[model samples]
Target chain A: MIVSGSGLVEALRAGRFVVTAELGPPRGADTDVVRKKGRALRGWVDAVNITDNQGGFVRLSSLAGSLVLLDEGVDPVMQLTARDRNRIALQSDLVSAAALGVRNVLLLSGDHPSYGDHPDAKPVFDLDSTQMVWTARNLRDHGQLLSGRSLDPPPDLHIGAVENPFAPPVGFRARRLAKKVRAGAEYVQTQLVFDVGAFAGWMAEVRDLGLHERAHIIAGIGPIVSPQALEHMRTKVPGVHVPDAVATRLLRAGTEGFTEEALRVCAESIHRIRAIEGVSGIHLMAFGREHLIPEIVDRSGLDRSRFDMNACGSRERSADAG
Target chain B: MPPPRAVPTRPALSSRTLYRLHRLLEPNGLYRFVARVVERHAWLRRPFTRTEESVKRKVFGCRMCGQCALPVTGYACPMTCPKQLRNGPCGGVLPDGGCEVYPGERCVWLIAVERAEAGGHAGDLERLHRPIDQRQWGESSWINYWQGRDDGLWTEPGGRATPVDLGLPVLVTGKGDRER
Candidate 1:
């Protein structure tokens, strides 16, 4: 059933298990990179997330990418990071994104610049991610900016935030989500879940706190692609926890059969994560391997017939009718 | 008792003692007297600020944001975080509780959560801490706390269901207010 506004929000609201995927805009001005990825993800996922300078590297803006995705009939969850922009720029971009018919937004603190390509760049974390979440919520719900200036037409947004359940202070991770929910995060996407057991442990705490009922908790998953990528994420990526057993399994698959084994691992994770209560959906992060998502989703045993691509496009014309 | 020294060489008081001391100084009258004395006695202010800074710097690696979050954060200083996050751990924290930016160092929030849970102040992590008061940087947080300068630092009332007031100008609800 096609909704008048954000299909991702509508799907989650309707209690349909949602699926979202990431799309990193290319470093150059080329629109084709975003479009090609968007086209590939259109029917398979409910919404595509356009990253905001992902990894702190300079790239085509997530705002521009979201616009391109809109042209491709895919709903875009435009990510807005607090790492680069202060309150003014952040709010300005948010208003502009809404006026241009961008519906979903994911607020993040972003990777510190040191982690990105430009290690020398001065980091601008004027507002932490939680504050950004609260700021966006106020703009959408109260029709006011952080400065208390009234917005004639406040940006209508489905506010979201990111969390890493496998990170340290795992016990406090769920409470952090609770704070975001209190700050008006309607949905949350987690850090990559290579360790399903640990992710489930965090979800159990989330359920204990009844946070799942308050906010849509979407588990993050990704196609490992290669043992090299697996090792990179295991050792290098912050917040990602890959159990040694999974590493052993993937490494044992060897180079020739690695692709098949990696996809199988991701698909199995999705299957296991689906059974965990409070998992409203999954956010697929198949970075640079967008083509693998459809097969991974199919392998996860999700009822693909229920994923109606026609109903999932951004419906801008009828968006404000509500 | 100090929760296994975050930096082994650093010396400090136990978090429980600090928490108790913090609670003791929270009453307005006690801190207000100190604030007034520090304000009136210019000669003494420098020594007072210096002593507080040097002591806290050694104990907590405090960056002296002039609004200490130590009590709420289980004595772990959020200002020391590479990103200086006051709310909670960011998504980039390493799996082993390492800082995302400084891979070798432990993420402060992880230590904070563990210490907070151990110290029986786990509920404070859920509070929506306000952004740093930039004007207070380098000043003594004790004086700021005593003068009630940091009283409004929380976006919402702690442990309450009050409506959020970020200290912004009040929202103009009516059409008449909008016209003005």
Candidate 2:
């Protein structure tokens, strides 16, 4: 079943470890890749997040990809970015997504224009991630605009925000997460996590500040594909750290066996994360390795029987079935 | 990629005017008068220059340059400036002037409108619809300015500290270093 924000929260309270995966749409107008990825992860995850622009590079609209996922019987967490839209567009998309029964959303401030293919294109940060969370909360809970104008019917959305545990001034992430929670974020999914200790410390701070009670915190884990990919993540992706031991193992595995190593690493990571008391769930960013998620889940020993498999067979299944 | 550009300097604001305004508002009587005037008329608060017709025309023809507010509004420009959409709105402006983005807060534009009206230029309201030139300044600089003002450092004696002084070495690094 498509989990509502409250449902996700309830699941966390019930000690269920929510699992989420990402689906990156193709760069062109094709929906095949997105649909395939969505279909592949159908019953393996709680929700499949359609990335707006993974790594800030240009790609198909996340909304479109999310729609495809919805069509494929996967609950989609449509990633909304303020980088290219104003409040009006943002609201319109939210309402549209809700109307289409795509309830989960990941609000993002998005990467700056400079990071994308179109550096000269103007960015529209009408609302930062925090403000977007507030907007989502207001729209969903109050059924009103900022001006208090009532919506014909308010949207019912599961709002989530991103947290980068590896961000510098690392101490500030917890506080930032606290602010997001204060702003009405129902859940927070972190950026790719390689160091469980760092993530644990960050969660400790969140607990200390009482934010844990307000939002479901999901640790993000991206499966490492190769030594080169691992090195790229460590050096290229700022704030993402791959531990020396993990990096060494992946390197020693070499190119051909990297996929196996990746699955093992990810499975272990999931296991470690699932053992954490305060951690509510795990967001798997398999990066183009969508096909391996089911294997990773199986190897990790997570209980997938709880997810609805019958719904995965057809697109017409009720979203609430799961 | 080209080397990162040097950080630009910020425009100067009159401390005398700010102090005078601060002092004037400190007295309950004067503050009430200003507040009363601002409360009655929306246009009086945020002054704009264009008429509805002109604004509409520009909106249809907007190139999205976002220049209208950058030079004048100090980086506090609205995301909805018809023509120039630099950044998103504060996410606080509610449909009714209360900010949904910032709970229990008045919209920034409403505050600006009130200030303009209180300052005696109600006609400026029409100008609020003008197209803005968003690219007039870099996003980082605009954000830096925004942050400085938010922290109350922008109005402090000497100009607010640069990203460099604030230990943002990345801001001073090569091309891609400070882009984001």
Candidate 3:
């Protein structure tokens, strides 16, 4: 039986063109920052993903940030990485998140600490991303831990895993997703995609495997916001593939009109991505610029009406606020 | 001997001998006897592990993970990956098939994938490898494998391994575990 634990899963299962966005928790112990970002993302997206120390920099815990989002009536997809925690801690966090009402989890192997602030920190990749997915599924379906111990009441979660079509061994990326699916990933959120042609080609292979029928494929898209950010993501960000054409266009746009041009590119990309066969949704990652998502979503010409907001718990919270 | 003189006996024997050797190495059948001998002598553990380390480190760049995955990973040591990814390549493989952490080097899993596909053992790549047993680090995996000590690391034919098979104690007990 499918555990429709989160509205994100429900929306996807109902064939709604879902829109999800990322929220980076602040580096300090500031709940207000999370709440503000959560509020900005509230109606614009179906769910907000609380990053788990994204980029390996120390920040507020993803669990705390997710709880803040939950308090603000924004559904949170709590990302759990295997880099920091072992299987025990991960399972503990999973059950804890469930107890606190966070139902969506996007499992990742996480960025190496060498790329983050604390390069000296010890990495505990006790489990890889696929193993983490299998752990979560084991908890949900079998009501057992990886050790096979029975949980009196298992933490019900919607399993999501990240895929990067732009990465090397491109031919094997689709098959990797197949492995994730077999491991029990119900949905897949891809890494930042700047080259639609490459993505479409990858999607063709995914179609050949009929993976789209088994899992919801959400393409990752984001506004560059600045030429510096564009370059950083293009060159510095691991697994993020930004083609030379994007860099050239952003360079031509210059600083004065870069944000507009970047958003225009993003909106246009969304239009193209929407038309791509088998893409169930778009995961907007507007790094540090949550306010622009509404404008980007509006400009993308995607029908927002398909998202039934009343079906979610956030509607009740908004009503209370009113 | 007279009948064998009619044919080129050396080529036929060489091919059959090579095939038998290959079959023997597949399960490390001969190594099991060596492992048992090493197991009986407690003093040989460190030396055996060090020897294994020197040989594998030179060839496969092995990290002495103790739960060796080389057979399934096209003989490429997955421990060499910056992240030590066992199941497959992480999403961070560079555009040119470079490692994410060390872009100059090719991603180990990518090499594993290509080699496995080439060797027609591509399905072996799909087998989900569990997390490494940290206790087994720097130990002799050959002896561990022969003794069935690392059975938990390898996926069972039925899919996931049970805790009993993994040799994990029932750590989560009644009231205290649920108290949280």
Top candidate by TM-score: 1
TM-score between candidate 1 and the true structure: 0.89
lDDT of 3: 0.77
Native interface contact recovery, all models: 0.62, 0.00, 0.53
Spell out the clash pairs found in candidate 1.
none
Per-residue lDDT over B95-160 for candidate 1, one digit per residue giving the tens place of the 0 to 100 score: 666677777778878778877878988777778876665657777888878887776666442342
Ranking by TM-score: 1, 3, 2
Candidate 3, residues A111-160, lDDT tens digits: the string is 98889999888777888898888778767666777676788798888889
Note the DockQ of each predicted structure.
Answer: 0.41, 0.03, 0.28
Off by over 4 Å in 2: A1-14, A311-322, B1-180
Candidate whose DockQ is highest: 1
Better of 1 and 2 by lDDT: 1
Predicted candidate 2 versus true structure: per-residue lDDT over A138-210, tens digit per residue:
6776565544465879898888888776654354456556556655677888887788887788878888977
The ten-residue window of minimal lDDT in model 1 chain A covers A313-322
Ranking by lDDT: 1, 3, 2
Residue pairs with backbone overlap in model 3: none
Put down candidate 2 lDDT per residue, B72-166, tens digits, no spaces.
22322343332122222222133334433232544434443444445553333222121112333322222222223212211121121122211
Give all candidates' CA lDDT scores: 0.79, 0.59, 0.77
- Of candidates 3 and 2, the better by DockQ: 3
lDDT of 1 by residue, A184-296 (tens): 78899998888899888999999998889989999899978897898788776776888888888888999988889989998899888888998899999988798998998
